[model samples]
Target chain A: MSTIEKNVPGTRELADLVREQEEELAHLRARLAEWERTYDATPQRDALFSTSSGAEVRPLYTELDREGSDPGNDLSLPGEFPFTRGPYPTMYRTRLWTMRQFAGFATAEETNERYKYLLAHGQTGLSVAFDFPTLMGYDADHARSLGEVGVCGVAISSLDDMERLFVGIPLDQVSVSMTINGPAIILFCFYVAAAERQGISAEVLRGTVQNDILKEYQAQHAWVFPPEPALRCIIDMFEWCSENTPNYNPISISGYHIREAGSTAVQELAFTLRNGFEYVERGIARGLDVDSFAPRLSFFFDIHNDFFEEIAKLRAARRIWARRMRDVYGAKKPESWRLRTHAQTAGVSLTAQQAENNIVRVAYQAMAAALGGTQSLHTNSMDETLALPTEKAVRIALRTQQVLAFESGVTNTIDPLAGSYYVESLTDLLEREALDMFDEIDALGGVVPAIEQGWFQGEIAASAMRQQREIESGGRVVVGVNHFMEGSEKIEIDRLKIDESVERLQVARMAELRASRDSARVDQTLAALRHASSGAQNLVPAILDCARASCTLYEIRHAMEEVFGSYKEPVFF
Target chain B: MSESIRKIRVLVAKPGLDGHDRGAKVIAAAFRDAGFEVIYTGLHQTPEMIVSAAVQEDVDVVAMSVLSGAHLTLFPRVKALLDDAGADHVLLTGGGIISEDDMAALDEQGIGKLFGPGTPTTAAIDYIREWFSTHEAV
Candidate 1:
C-alpha cells in the first residue's frame, strides 16, 4: 500500500520544463520517425534482443528515455537518500567487497581444514554450507539422513561438531555466515555456545545467518515449522540479537535462491524486498523499534547473466527499500534506509558442458556484482554444475573476485554507471515494475498468504518453464548447451568427492558425545526450551542453554516442533 | 478402426532433503507439455514415499532427482524397492548434479540413463519414449 511518489518536483516546475522540451521533443520525434523508416528498410540478423528475463531491449537508449525524471531525485549521490548510486560514498575505495566463498562438505574436521585453507588463500570472510541433515535439523544417524550425511555440506549435529568446525580459528577475528534456514535458531545457538567456549562473548560476535524462511516456502522449499511459528522464531532472534549480539545479523533476507529457482530479475527484486518488508512488519508487531532491528537487516541477491539488468536490479532494490523504510515504515534513522547486500553469481547460469567456459561467465558476473555495489560476493565455480567444487576451482573463483577488485580497475570509481542513460532508465523501469508487483502481492493479502496459495511458486515455475522452452526451441543461445557444437567433449575438471566414511565418523562422534554429555542437564534444558517454545518469551536464551548442555540440532528442533509442528508444503508443480 | 495408445505416465519425484527442485519442476512441466502424464511428488520425498507413489500412480517411469550427492544411496534403494514390489518393469531414471562416472556406476546397477545439468528436456522425453517403446507392450 506504500506509494513510490516520495520525492518529486513541483507540478508547476514539471509543467514549465515540459513546455521547454516540447518543441525539441517534437523535432526529435520527427527525426526518430525518419530514422525508423530507414532502419526498417535495413534487415538485421534474426535474434532475440531481450534480457534473460524476457524484457525487451530497444536498440538505443538516449536522453529521451529519461525525459521527465529529476536527476537529483532519481540518481541520488552515494550515501544519500534512496541510495541508487551506492550504499556508501566510498564504496570499494575504502574497503573491497568480501570474497566469502560458501564452502563445506563431509565431516567437521574436513570442512574445518577447508575453511583454514580458504582463509590462508585470502578469502575475506567465511560462509558455511551445511549438509542436508544439518540444514533439515536431522542428526547424522537419523534414518532420513542415510546417504545424505555430510554429502552436500558440513554435517554439524551437535555443539561438539560446531566446536570442531571452528577449531583453531579465532571467532573474534573472522566473520562467519551460515546458510541455514529451517534450524537457523539451533545452529545460531550452537555458534554462540562455540564462541563462548573459545572465551569470546556474544557482544563481539560478527556474522550473518540466512534465517529467511519465507523464501524457503516460495523458492528454496526448506522449512521445519509452518509459516506462523517459523516467523515467530525469526522475530525472537531479532529481539535477542538486538540486545545480545549487537554486531551480528540475525537474518539475511535472501533473493539468491529465488533467482536461482528461475525467477526473472524483476520477480527476484520484488519478492525479496517484499519478504524483507514482511520481516520488518513482524519485528514491529513484536514491539521492537524499527531502527534497532532494521539497521541489522541485510540482503542477498543473485548476479545473473544480464549485466546491466543485474546492476539495475541492485540499484532498484536499494532505492525501493530506502523509500519504503523511511516513507512507509517511518524509520528515522539513516542506517535503516541503507540496503546493504551480499551477492553471488548465478549458479543456474552455469553449463555442465565446456565447464571451463563457466570461468569466463563467472568473471563477467563477478564484475557485474562489483559494479552493482555488493558488500560481499560468492562466485560460482566452473565444476559446480557437476559436483562440489574442487580446491583449485574454488581458489580460481576467489581469484576472479580478486582480479576484479585489483586488476580490473573497476573499484576506482563508485557507481560508474550512475549517469548512463540506459542504466538510469532501466533502474527506473525495474523500480516501477517492482512497485506494480508489490501492488499485486498486496492484493493477494501479502507474502505469507500468497505463499500458502502457491502464487509465488507458480510464477517462478512458469518463468522457469518459459526459459527451458526457449533453450530447447533455439530461441535462446547457450554456448555449450543448445547452440554451440561441442560434441564428444569430455569434462576434465577435478570434482570433489565426499568420502563415505565421513558419515560413519560423524555418526560415531554423535554417539560418543551423547554418551559423554550429562544426560540430566541435557534433558532439563531441552524441557525448558520446549516449555518456552509455547510461550511468548524470547527463545534464544533457552536454546543457548540447551546448546551449552550439549543438546543436538535435532533435539532443539524437535523441542520446538513439539509445540510448532512440522510444515508440509502444498503439492503442486 | 485406429487403435488408441496409452499415454506414458511418469512420476517426477525429488528424493532427498536438497530443496533444489528447479530441475525436477522444469522436467515435469516439459513432460506435461510433451503430451505425457507427469505426477510431481514435490520436494523431500524419501525413497519409500517415491516407490509407493510410483506404485500407486502406476507410472510407467519413476524419475527421481537426487542433487544432494545421495544418488549412490537413493537411486539403488528406490530401484530395489520397485523390484521388490513386483514393479521391476518401471524405468528408474532421473537427473541431477550426478557425475559421469557415478552415472555409469548407477547404470551398471540397473538404473536408467541419468541426465546432468544443462540437458535439453527433449533428450529425456525421447529417451523415455524410446524406453517405453521397447520395455512396454503397446
Candidate 2:
C-alpha cells in the first residue's frame, strides 16, 4: 500500500524511498531464505493427471503416459497425406465453411419462406428436414400418413410440392442438403424434376442429401427398404453424382445420430467412419474408381458439451480416416483420403425446464465445433428442446453463430489450441481409442453385420443407460433441472404450434395430386416397383419412376411391406 | 395369500413424427429394466395404430411420449377408444412438452401421469411401480 503513497509533486520522494528500501529488502530476503531452509517444507503431489477421453485422473503425465507408444509422425501441410489439421491448405483464410442450418416446417410454402429468410440472414447453405412420411417413403394423405402430415418437418409428396418448396429459390446457385435417408434417390429425383422445370440442369445443382441408410438402421431408424437394396441405391447415387452432379456431395455418412442415440465419442467416430468406409467399399465393389466418389463422401458428427473431447474427436477423425484410406484402401488421390465433416451441436443434451441455460451449452458446443474445424455447422436453437424452433429463436441461434464467427477473434489463428499438452495428448488418445473400436468393428466384418446383430444398438444402449443412471443418481448436474430445480419458474414461451388446418389443407393437396395425376401410370409404377422388390435390380431407378409417376411414399412402403415384410427387432438385452 | 400375480404391461409408444427417440427409447429401456414388459411400437406410430396395438396386446398402461405437441389430439382419442373397448383398467398417460395447466386439465379427464422434461427416469419407474402395485387390488 505504501509503494505509491506520494503525490505527483512529491513523486521523486517516493522513488527515493524505493531506492532506500531496495537495499533493506534484499538483506531481509537473504535472511528469510536462510530461515526457510530450516522451516518451510511442503509435500508436492497436487498435479492432476488424466487421459484425453476425460477418464481417470492421476498426479502426473510422463513418458509412462506415452507407455511404449510413439507420439507418431504427423504429415506436413494441410491437404497432404494424412490431413490431421484440415482438409484444405488455406482453410477459411481463403473461404469460410458453409453455414448450413437444418430448416423445414408444416408446409412446403412455409419451409420455402424460411429458406429465403435464412439465405437473407447470412446463412450460406440450406439443409431440409422432411416430415416422417417423406423420410419413410410415404406421401402425405396416404392412409398410413393420416394425422402426421407436416408434424416433424415439411411434407414433400410429389413434384408439385417440390416445385412450390423451391419456387423462388434458384437450384443452380443455392446448395440444399436434404435429411432424407431411405428414399434418398427418389427424393433427389423429385428435386431434379423440380429443378428441370425451372430450367436448371443436374451439372449446375449443388448440396448433399444425408442419403446414408446404414446409419438409419444403426441409429436413426427411419429406414424403408432392406439393407442390400439400400446400399445399392446409395452406390447408384455415388455413381450418378460422380458422373453428373460434380458440385454435389452424394452422401453424408452420419455419426451425429449415432452419438445422439447415446453413444460415446469413440463409438461415434468409429461407427460413422466405418459406415463411410463400407459405402466406399460398396462403391469400389460396383467397379467404380475410389478417386471418383470418395471426394464427395462427407461425414457428420455431434458437438456435445465436452469441449476438448469434441475437438480431439474431429482431429482424430480426420487422422484416422486419412490413414485408413491411404494405407488400407490405397486411395491415390489426396481428396479421396481426407475426411471433411459437418457438425451439429448435441440436440439430446438440451433441457427445457431452464431453457436459457441451453444457450450457454450451445455456445460451448458451437465453440467446440469451430475448434474442431468443421466443414459446416448447425447450431441448435435453445428452444428446440421443445418443438421446431420459432423464427425469433432461430434468428437468435443464427446470430450466436455469427457472434462466434466474427467477434470471438477465434479465426485469427489456425488450430490456436493445437499444442497444449492436454489437447495434443487427448488427440492421440482419442485416435487410439477410436482405432481400437474400428479394429473391433472390423473383426465383426464391418458396420452392416454390427447393425444387423444389434451390436451398434447394444453399445449405444449400454452407454445411454450408464449416463441416465448417473443423472438420476445426482452424479451429473444439469443445472436448473434435477439439482437446482426452481419447481415453478413462470415459463411463458410462445410455442410454435402447427395448425390443425395444416393437416386438412395437406390432405386436400394430396387428394388433388391423386386425382390430377395419370392413374394408369401411377398403378403401373407401383406394380413395377413391387416387381423390383421381388427381383435383385437396384431400387433407385424404379423408385424414381414411381416418384415421377406421382406415387406416394406410403403407397410404395405398403407395397414393399407386402413383399419384404416388416422388420421385427430382436429383444436387445 | 391374496393373489398378487399380474405383470403390469406398459405399452410405451412414440406417437406422431418426432424422430428424437432418445427419451422414448431411454424410458422404454427404464421400464424394461424395471421388469415391466414394455412394448415399444418404434417411431412414427399413429394414434389409431397405437391404441389398437395396446388393445390387441391387452396392456395395463399406455404411455406415449411425444415431444411434438400433438398430444392434445393424440392422447384423448386413445383414452376414448380404451373407454369404448371397455379397457378402463388401462391407464392412459403421456409426457413431453406439456405445461402444468394443460397437464392438470388433462389429468382431470383421468390421465394417469403427465411427466414432463425434467421428470426423472427413476421417478417414472417409481410412479408406474407404485400405481400398478396399488391398483392391482382393484
Candidate 3:
C-alpha cells in the first residue's frame, strides 16, 4: 500500500473518485427503490411473469442486477476462452448459419427427390429424417415394421437405400446430418458404405450422425442396448472417427429430443452439455486425447418460445463447455474448448389449432438461434403438429431462416446483445442453475447412473407435467390453445398423406434385396460382427463390412444384441 | 342395496415405434390424479401386447398414444384385437398428432373420441369419466 501510494500520483484522487462514485451509486439505488415501489403499486396483468423455465422476470434489469458478474472474464471476445459471446470471431459476418431442413418420408427414391428439391430451393445442408422402423433398427419387411414403414421419416434399411437417398448428390459437396439414434452406429456404417460406393473416401466425408444414446435412455426412449454397451459403441465411433473421418462428427450430443420430450431450457442445456462431457470422459477413458475427439464433438439444442432465455442458454452452454474442457478436462486445444451447436425450433411449442401461428413461433425461435450463435439451424414447419410437414410448409420454414439471415439485421454484428444487462444476468443464472444440476448429477454417480435411477426421466416428466398444468390452469398462455378460442375454425391447410403402398413397396424391396445380394457374404459379415461384439475390438470396421455386404439394419442390430443384450426401460409414469 | 362404485381402470399404452411419451405419461398421471387406476405400458408396444395388457388388466379404457402417424393402422388393429380377445367393451381412446379427418375415421370404427395437440388433459379425463358413467354399470 505504501509503495502504491508512493508510485501513483493520483492515489488520493482515486480514493476520492471511488467515494464520489459510491455516493452516486447510493443515490441511484435509492431512486431505483422508489421506482420499483411505483412500478409495484401500478396495476398489472394477472399472469405469471416468468420464462418458460419458470424463472421470474422482474419489471426492470440494470447494472444493479449484474452486481457480482465480472464482465471481462465472464464474457471475453468471441473466439476466446469461455466463449460466451460467440464461438468464432466473425460469426455470421463471414458466412451465415447452414439452413438444414430435416426432411424424410416414404421410400428412399422419394426422399432423394425431396432432397434435390430442398437443395434447389437454397438449402445449405442435408438433414436426413429416418422413419420409425429404420430408427429402431428394423428392416422394412420386419414384422415390427408392418404399419410403421416410412410413416415418420424415410425408411433406410440397407446401403442400397442409403445410396438411393443420395443418388446424384455429391457426398463431398453436401454436408448431411442424419437424425438416427438407437442403431446410430449401424446407420452410420451404412452411410459410410454408401459414400464409398460413390467413390468418396471416409477422410473426405463431412457430416454428423446423431449418435447420442444417453438422451435416448433419459428422454427420447429409442434405445437398443443397455447404457454400458450403447456407450461402448459410441466410444468406439469416437475412436474410429478420430482417425478415419477426422472431418465428420461421429455424435451430435443432442438436447433437442430432451427438450422436445419436455424439459425446461436450463435442463436441456445442462443435460445436453453433461452428455457431451460424458462422451469426452468416455473417449479419454478409452485412451484417446481430449483434444482429439472433443474438437469434433458437436451439440444440438432446442430453441423454445422464451426468446431471451433460449439465447442465454446457448451462451451459457458455450461458456460452461469451454471452461469444462480447458479447466476440468485439461484440454490444450482451442477447438476442444469451443462448443459448436446446431439448434432447431421447438416442435412441442407448435400447435394444431391456428397452425399458421407456428410459422411466427418458428421465425422468432430461428432469430433466437441466430442471435445465440448457432452454427446451424432447423426451423419446424407449421403443419408439423398435425402430421409430417408438406412441401410448401417446409419451404416456408426454410424461408424463415433465409429471412433471418438476410433481412434481419441481427447478423450484422457478432453477439449484438452481449452487453445487455438482462441477457448477461440470465446467462449467469442459467449457468449457475446448470452447474448446480451437474453437482446433483455427480451426487447420483454421473449421467448413466442417474439415467438408470430414472432421475433424468423423472425430472423431465415432472417439468413436463408442470408445464402442462400451467397451460391447462391458465398459468401459462398458449395462443389458440388455452387463451384464444377460434370456435368452429376448421383447419384448411393442405395436409400431406403418405400412401399406405409405400410400406408394401419397401417390403417388396427388402425381399428383393435379400434374394439378390450374396447371402453367404451377409451371413459371414454378421457372424464376424457378432464375434467382434464379444471382444475389445472397435465395432465400426466389423459393422462397415456388414453394411457393404448389404446386411439389413436389424441383422447388424440382432448380431450385436446377441452380445450387448437389449434395454427395456423401467416403466413409470 | 349399498353398491360399491367401481373405479375406472385405464391402460395407457404407446403403440408402434413412436418414442414420444410426454402425452401418454401426462394423460396417465392426470387420469390417476382424477381418481382412476392407471396401468402404463411403456414405449414400442405392439398391438397384441397392448390388447393383452388391456384384457389382462381388465381395464375399462385402453388409451393408446400413437404419434408416428401409424394411428390409422394401430388404432384399428388394437380395436380388432380387443374385440377378438372378448374385451370389445373397453374404450380405445387416446391422442397424438392426429387430424380431425382421421379422428372422425377412427370414431366411425367405434373408437372413442380422440384428442389432439393443445387438448387439455382434463378433456380426456372428463371424456373418459362421461364414457365410463354411461357405458359401465354405475
Candidate 4:
C-alpha cells in the first residue's frame, strides 16, 4: 500500500477502470467539433470571462486542477478555526436548522393566533415582525404612530401586548427571533418579562433579538437615536444576553437589508462585514473582551436568485470571517471563528403577478441558502407579494424547506459542492473583492463615518441604479416580465386581504389597554427612562423598567428623543 | 425620449408602515440611472406626507410601493388627498401585491396603473414615460 491509499485505488486509476473506453478526454477536440456541428454552430470557445462578482469561467477542471490551488491548506475542521464547511461539526445531520418562519399580523391576539399556528405546523423557532410603531420606537397612541398601528406587522405598545403575544406558546422550549431593531433592548426586555410570567427562568431562555442598530442606521433606516446612544443600547443587550440568556444571539449582524438595499454581491459582502467589524469595535470600545461575547454573535444574510454566486458568497463569508477573527481580531476560541448565520429567501424576487410563481423563486432561494450552509432559514410565502401571508401560504413555504432537506438528497453529504473549481475560484474572487472593500472602508476610518459622510449611502444608490438600468435596457430578463409577453397570465391566486374588522378590534384593544394600566407607574418609569437617557448608562435596564411599569413604546421612545434626538436624513438624489 | 427634460422627476416613496423598501429603493435607483430624479422617502410615511411631498417636489409621477397589504386603505387615502388638493396632474402610480381586478378598480378611482412584482424595472420606467406624456396636459 502506498502513502496515498492503504488499499483503495487513486482517482485517476479508478476513473480509468470505471469508464475505460467511455473516457472522451483524449478526443475532446474532435467530439467538440462534432457536437457543435450537430447541436450548436460555434466551435471556438475562449471568449468567456469574469461575471459581475469577478468569478472567472474556464472550460473545465480536473483532479490536476485541484492539486495546484491552495486546496492543501486545511480550512480547519467544522466547528474549528475558520469554519468554512459549517459552524457545527454535526450540522443538520445531528439537529436540523431551526424552522424560524416570520410571524406577525395586525393585533396582539391576531398575531398570537399566527404564532400558535406556526408552532402547530412544526415550526421549531419563532420570528416576530413588529409593526412600524414598535420598530420606530413609537407607541400605537403616539401621533407619529397614528394610522400606522399594526399595518405591516403586529403592534406591541406595552407589556400587555407582549403578554398576549405568547399566550399559549411555551416560551421555554421554542427559540424566538424578534425582528425588532431601533428599540431592540426594550423589546428584548419585554420578552424576558413575558417569559418570567410564563414561569420560565432567564437561564433556560433561548432566542435572538435583531439588536443590529448599526445596520438600521445604514440600510434599514429604523433608527430612533443618534449613533452613540443607539450603540449603547445594543451593548447593554450583548452584556445582558451573555450573563442572563447565554444561548441568545444578541445581534444578528445583517447583510440581508444591505443586499436588499441594491448593493452588488461584493458590496453586500464588504459592507456587511464592515458593519460587523464596526459592531465588534463598538463592543471593544465598551471595554468588553472580544472572546467574552463574540461566540453568541451571529449573522443574517439575504439568499438572492443568483444560484452559484449566492452559494459562493456564503462560503466566502465563513472563510473570511474565520480568518479575520483569528488573524486580525485575535480571537483564539474556535467558536469565535465560526460564522453561524440565518438566511431568508430573497424578498426582492417575489413577483405580484402569478403570485404563485414566488413559490418557485422561494424554493430556489431556500436551496441556495441550504447549499450555502445556513444554520436557520425563513422562506417568504408566495402570497407575501400581496399582504401578510395566510396560513396556507406559510405552510407551503415550510413544505418547500422540508422537500429540500429530506427529499432532495442535498443534505446527505457535507459541503457536497466544495472544491468545485468554478465554485472555489468564485469563492476566492468574492473574498478578494470583499477584502478590497474592507481595505477601502478601513481607509475611510470605518462604517459610521462612511455612513455619516454619505459615502456608503451613495454607493448603495449608485449600485442600485446600475442594476436598474441593466434590467430596464432589456439586458436582464425577469421571467413573466418584459421579455416574454404572454396573454393575461393565469393567476389562480388569492391575495391576502387584511379585514378592516382587524383594525377595529386592534383599536378597541388599545383603548382597553390604555384604560386598565396604571398611569402613575408609567409616568414614573418614563421619568426614570428620561433620567437614564441623559447620562452615560445603558438603556436596557431602564427600558425594561418601563416595560414592567406598563410604559408604552411611544412613551419610552419620546422620552429618549427628548434627550437623545432623532435623525433628519441627508438630501441625496 | 421625447423632450430633453432636466430629469424624469419621479418620487419613489413608500406610504404606510411597510418596512420592506428594498424593491422601492432598487426601483428608485433604476429610475435614477434611466435619467430620472428619484425622491426616496425612507420607510413609514403617511399618505398625507407622500401627497404633500409629491406636490412640493412637482414630480412627473408619484410611484407608491406598499407591501403591508394596506394599499386598499392607503391608495384611496392618497387619491383622496391628491384630489382634494387638486394635484391629480401628478401621474399617480402604484406597485406591490395589488391584484389586476383591484388594479382596475383603483384605476376607476383615478389612481392609474398598478405594476405588480417581477414587472421589470424598465417596464415601470417606460410606463412612467408614457404616463408623463399622455397626462402631461393635466
Candidate 5:
C-alpha cells in the first residue's frame, strides 16, 4: 500500500483516488492525441525502424511492456543459477576481463615480438592467428602455400615455429587461444609439445584451441576431413583433454565466424548454441559423462554494432544455455550450467573509408562486450578492414579495451541495464526467437545434416543479401560510406605491408629445419599416424608423437586425409 | 529473346582455403540478378578442379576469389590449366586481399582484372558481361 492509502485508512478512499488518476490519465491521453494530430512529423525514409535481426524498435516503452515478465524470479543474482547477471558474483570487481588481443603476421619470429609487445602493454592473454597455409594444413614449402606463407598471419609448419612463437613467454603463466579450425588438432599438439619443452606439464597448461570443425563447415570453410571423421576427431580431443589437461578447453564453440559470414545476432546465437549442444551430445554418444566435458566448453561470440541487442543476446545466451544444460542435459554442476565466453568486436562492422571511425566503433563494441559480462575480449583494430593491423593500430585497439576497463563506470555495477524496460523485453524476445530457430534446426534433423543441406549457408547468405540491399538502397546509413558526404578521404596513416622477403626467410627456415631433423624418425611417426587413422584409436597421441618427431602440420593432416578423405562443400543457391 | 542476347554462363570458384566468401556470395547473387547463369564451385577448389569444372560446364567466364594471398600463384596456375585444356577462350578474372603490383603482374600474365575488397558487386558483373560481349566469337 502506498503512503496515501495508509493515510486514507479505508479501501473506499484508495479506490476513489485510483478513479481520479484514471480520469486524469484519460484527459492526458486525449490531449496527447490532439497535439500529435496537429504536430507535423518530420519526413522519414521508412515507416518503422527495425534492428538488423528484424525486431521493430518502438518509440516508447512503459510499465505495460514489463507487466508479464517477473524480475525477481528470472533476474537472479550474479553467479547464481541461470547466470543472466554474470558468470561470477564479483565480475570485473574482483578482476577485469582478460584483454586477449588476436595478433599474428608474416613469420613466427615477427609474431613473437608482437606477442611480447602486447603482453608488456597490459594484454592478459595471447590469441594466435595462423596464416592461410597453416590454417589449411599445408607446409610453407608446399605448392599450395606458394606466395601465401607468412602473408595473412603467422605460418607454423612444424613444432620449431610454435616453439619460437612463445620463446620468452612461459606457456603456463598466460592462457593462449588459437584461431585455427580445420588443422586445429595438429596445432594443439604443436602447442602441447612446445609447452612440454618449456617444462610445463599438460595438466597445468590452460588455453583454448578453436577445435570447432562444425562452424568451419557452416561458415568458415576451412576443414580438411569430412564431417563424420572430423566430429570423431573432435570427440577424441574432448575425451583426451578431459584426462590429460584439466584446465584446457578442448574446443571453443565459436559463433564469431558465423556472424562475420553475415548472420544476424539471433542466428549467431541459435546456431552457435545448437553447435555446442551437438558437441555435448557427441560426447555423450561417445560414452562420456555430460559433466566431464561440458564444464570445460567455452564460447566465442562477435559483439556487433547494436549495443543493447548484443548485450541482450549475450544475456539470453546464458539463460537459455543454463536452462538447457540443466533441464534437458541433466547437468548437475553449476560450472556446467554457466556459459563462459570470449568476445571480439565485429570486424564486419569496421569500415575502410574514414578508417579512424573504426576506433570509436571498436570502443563501443568493447563496452557492450564488457556490459554483457564477457570473460575476455578482443577489439578489432581500426585498419583491420583494410589489412592486417600495423603495430600502432593494434596498440590503439588494445588501449580501447584498457580505457573501458579503467574509465567506464559500467563496471561499477553488474548488469547495469538489467532492469530497463527495453532490455528485458528484448532479452525475452531474443530468447524466444532463438528457441524457434533451434526448433527449426531440430526439425532439419540436427546441425550436421543441416550443414550438409546448406541451410545455415542459405540463411546467412539471405541475411547478407538483405543487409547489402538495405545499404545500397539508402535505407541503412553507414556513416562514412553512405552518409557524411565529403571529399574522398585520403588515408593518412601508415599501412602494414608484408615484404616478399618474409616469405623467403620462412621458406629458408623450413628448408633448414627439414635438413636438420631426422627424416627417418619423421617418416616412422607419420606412418604410425596413418596407421592409427585407419583404426579406432585416438589420433591426438599419434599426432603428438608426430609433432615430437618433427613432422610438419601438413604431414599429419595428409596422413588423416588419406584415410578419412577431404571434405567438399555442397553448393547452394 | 533475341539470338544476340544469349544467356551468359559464368562459373564462380573459390580456389583456395580462404573462407571469406561474403564477397564471392554477393557477386554470385549480383550475377544472378544480372541474368547470368552462375555455377558456384564451393570452397577449397584446386586449380585443376576449378579448370575442369569450367571446361565441363563450358562456362564463358571463370571468376575466382582467393583472399589467401596466393593469387599470384593460384591465378597463373588456373590460367595455365585453362590454356592446356583448350578452354582458353574462357575469360579468367578474380579478386582478393592483393596488392597493386601483384594485381598488375597477374593481369599482365593474361589473367583478367583483379578487384580489391570493397569493389561493388556490379563492377564484377559488368566486367564479365563486357568481356563476353567483346569476345563472343572467340
Candidate 6:
C-alpha cells in the first residue's frame, strides 16, 4: 500500500493540517494583494466568467479545491478500470483520432466524389449525411419528396444508389459512419448488400449507424416508428451485428442532436447515457449477454463552445458509464466498461453573421473535442449556418483536424486537463448534476416513459428558451451577432448548391429501377420482412433480403410500417 | 385596444418531413404572449390537412413553416388549396431555410411576407396584426 493510503489520518490530524494550510494561504493572499496594488492591475472583464450552461467559473484554482475530497481509486491509470482519463492507454500516440468529415449532398455520385476528395486530403474515415427525404425513408420519386430530394445531403433510395456511393471505395478498408436514425436499419441493409456486391464479407465490415431512435422523439424529431417498435428494431440490429458484423457498431447513442436541439451539456450527457442504458437493458431483456453487445456500443457527442465544460462532460461521461456498466449492470469484461465516443463541433454555435469567425470557433471546439479524448471528430465548416459547405470550406475544415493532430501539441499528452482543479471540480459537478437528472428520469419511470410524457422535450425547450433569452437580452454576447457589429458585406464564399437536374435524374433512376426489377421477388421479400417484423424473428436478415431483391428503401419501411404502424409524435412545447 | 376587440386567430402549421419546430414553437409562444389565438398544427401536416385545419378553425392567417427544403412544393400547394377553397383572404405566410430566389418566387406565388431565421418574432406578430387591421372581412 502507498504511504497516503496506509496513513489514514484521523479527523483531528486532518483538521490540524488544514488549519496550518489555511494560515499559509492567508499570508499568500496578503502578498498577492500587495503585488496587485503595486502593478495597479485589473482583470479584463468586470463580469464573472461562466460556462455556456451557466456554471460560475472562479478566477483562480488551488489545492484547496480538492482539500477534503479523497478521489480514492477513481483516479486510476488511463486504460484501467473506470477510464476517466481515456478509453485507451496510448491515446493519440498509437493512432490519431479519426478525422471523419460529415459530407454528403446532391446525388450519390456527387457525394461519392466529395468522399473521394476528403479521403485524398487525409481524412481518416467517412461520415455520411443523408438528405431529408432519404432520412424520412422516402424514395426520390415520392410526391412528398419533391424539391427536397438532394437538398440537405445525399439521396440514396436503393441498393443501386448505395452501390454507386461506394463505387471505387473499398468496403474492407474504410470505416463509414452514417448519420441516419429513422430508416437506419434499411440503410444498414443497403450498405451490407452493397458490400456483398463488392465481394466483401459482412463479418469484415466496419462502420457505425446512428440508429438511436429514442433521441429522435426527444430531440431531433426524425423518428419513423413508435418508441416501443423503434426500440425493437434497434435491438434487432444489436443481436444481428453481434453475430454477423462484429466490427461495426450497430448504434451510436447520440447526444449531438440532443445538444443541437438546445439541451445544456448536463442534459445531453444524462439523457444520452440514459438512452444508452435503456438500449443495454432492452438487449439484456432480449436474452443477449451484456458483455457480448456492450463492447460494440459507441457514443457521439457535440463539443459546444464551452471548452473546459465540454471536456469535463466527456470525462464525466466515461466515468459514469464505466461505473454503471461494471457496478450497476455487473459486466465482467473491461471493454464493456469503456465508453468510446465520436464528437462533432456544435452546429448551433455557428452563426450566419461574420461566417469566417466560425473557422476560429470550430478550431477551438475541435481542440476541446481532442482534449476531451474523442476517438473520432468532425469539425463543422464555416458555411454550415448559411448553406452546405463548398469544397474550399470543407478542405479548410479538414485541415483544422490535421493541424490539431500534427502541429498542435495537444496530442502529446493523454487527458492533459485531467488533474486541473477546475476541470476535476467541473467533472465532479457535472457528474452530480447528471446523476440527479438520471434520478429524476427514473422517478418518471425511465427514459421511454419520460419521453412519452414530454418531460425530456420540456427540459430541452426550457434550456433553449433560457439560452435564446440570454442572446436576445445581450446577457450572452455572440461576438459579431450581439456585439462588434459589422455592416453587411456580400458573402464571397461559394456555397454548395444541389442542381435541380440532380433530383430529376434521381427520380428517373428510381423509376427505371422499379420498372426493370423483378416485382414478384420484391413482393416476396417485402412480405417476408413484414412477417418477420410482426413475429419474434430478427428483422435484419429479412431487410437484407429485400435489399438483395432490389426493394427500395420506402418499400422496406412501408412493409414494416404495415405491421408495426407509423408514429406521430406527441407535440410538446 | 379595447378588451372587447377580437383576438386574431392564426394557424401555425409545420407541413413537411422536417421536425425542426424550434422556430415554429418559439413563434407560437410569442404570438400567444401577444394575445393571438394560435393553433399550432404540429409536425408532418400535409398541405391538405393544413387547409382543412384553417377552414375548420376559421383562422384568419395560415403561417406555414417548412425547413426541409420542400417549400417549393408545399408552399405553392398550400396557396393553391386556399385559393381553390375561396379562402384566398386567409393570409398564407411562412419561413425557414428558404433562399432569396425561392422566397421571391414564393412571394410572387401569393405567399405573403416569409420570415427567415433571425427575423424577430415580433416582426411576425406585427405583420399579422397589420394584415388583420387592413383586411377586415366583408
**Residue-level lDDT tens digits of model 5 in A452-509:** 9999999998988888787766688787776774742555556787878887888898
For model 5 chain A, give the 10-residue run with minimal summed lDDT: A1-10
- Scoring each candidate complex against the real one, what DockQ results? 0.85, 0.41, 0.87, 0.44, 0.56, 0.52
Cα lDDT tens digits for candidate 4, A1-573? 122346787899988876753455446556655765765564664342445443565555444334445643434455655566678887777877777898887788888888888888888899999887788877776666655677778888878889999998888888889998887777888888888889998788887888887777667778777887788788877777788888889889988887787777788888888788777777888888888788899999998887888888888899898888888888888888788899999876776555677899999999989888899999999877566787899999999998998899888876777878677777777888999999898788887777787777778767766666655565655655545647327676655655666556666776887788888988898999899889877777788888888777777778988998886555454
Query: Taking the tens digit of each residue's C-alpha lDDT, what string does model 3 give over A458-526?
Result: 999999999999988988888888777775266878988899999999999989999999999999999
Candidate 1 structure quality by residue, lDDT tens digits, B1-138: 333389999999999898989989999988998899999998888889999999999999998888889999999999999999999989999999899999999999999999988888999999998898876644
Cα displacement (Å) at residue A87, model 2: 0.8
lDDT of 6 by residue, A407-435 (tens): 99999989899779899989988999999
Candidate 3 DockQ category?
high
Ranking 2 against 4 by TM-score, winner: 4
Docking outcome class, model 4? acceptable
Kindly report which residue stretches of model 6 are placed more than 4 angstroms away from their true locations once superposed.
Answer: A1-48, B1-4
Q: Listing every candidate in turn, what is its Cα RMSD in Å to the true structure after a full C-alpha superposition? A: 3.3, 9.7, 2.6, 4.9, 3.9, 3.1
lDDT by residue (A1-573, candidate 2, tens digit) is: 222335554688778988876677677667766665654474655332332233754333433334343333453456655677778877767777678889998999999999999999999999998887788777787665665678778998887888899988989989999999977877888887788889988889989989998888887878777787678778988988887789888899899998888888878888888888899899889988998999999889999977888998898888888888888787888889889889999998888877878788888899888887788899998878666788888888788888888889776567666655566667787888887888898888787787778888888877877778767877666777757888526565556767878788888998988889999998998899889878866665677687778876677667666777664444443
lDDT of 3 at A26: 86
- Looking at candidate 4, what is the lDDT of residue A457? 72
Q: Once superposed on the true structure, which residue ranges of model 3 sit more than 4 Å away at CA?
A: A1-17, B1-4
In order, what fnat does every candidate score?
Answer: 0.87, 0.34, 0.85, 0.49, 0.53, 0.37
TM-score of chain A of each: 0.96, 0.87, 0.97, 0.90, 0.93, 0.94
Candidate 5 interface RMS: 1.9
Model 5 earns a TM-score of 0.92
Write down the TM-score of every candidate.
0.96, 0.87, 0.97, 0.88, 0.92, 0.94
Which CAPRI quality tier does the interface of model 5 achieve?
A: medium
Q: Which sections of candidate 5 miss by over 4 Å?
A: A1-48, B1-3, B80-89, B99-110, B136-138
Query: On TM-score, who's better, 1 or 5?
Result: 1
Q: Name the runs in model 2 displaced over 4 angstroms.
A: A1-54, A57-72, A524-545, A555-566, A571-573, B1-7, B16-19, B32-58, B99-105
Q: Model 2, A16: alpha-carbon shift in Å?
A: 50
Q: Which ten residues in a row have the lowest lDDT in candidate 6 chain B?
A: B1-10
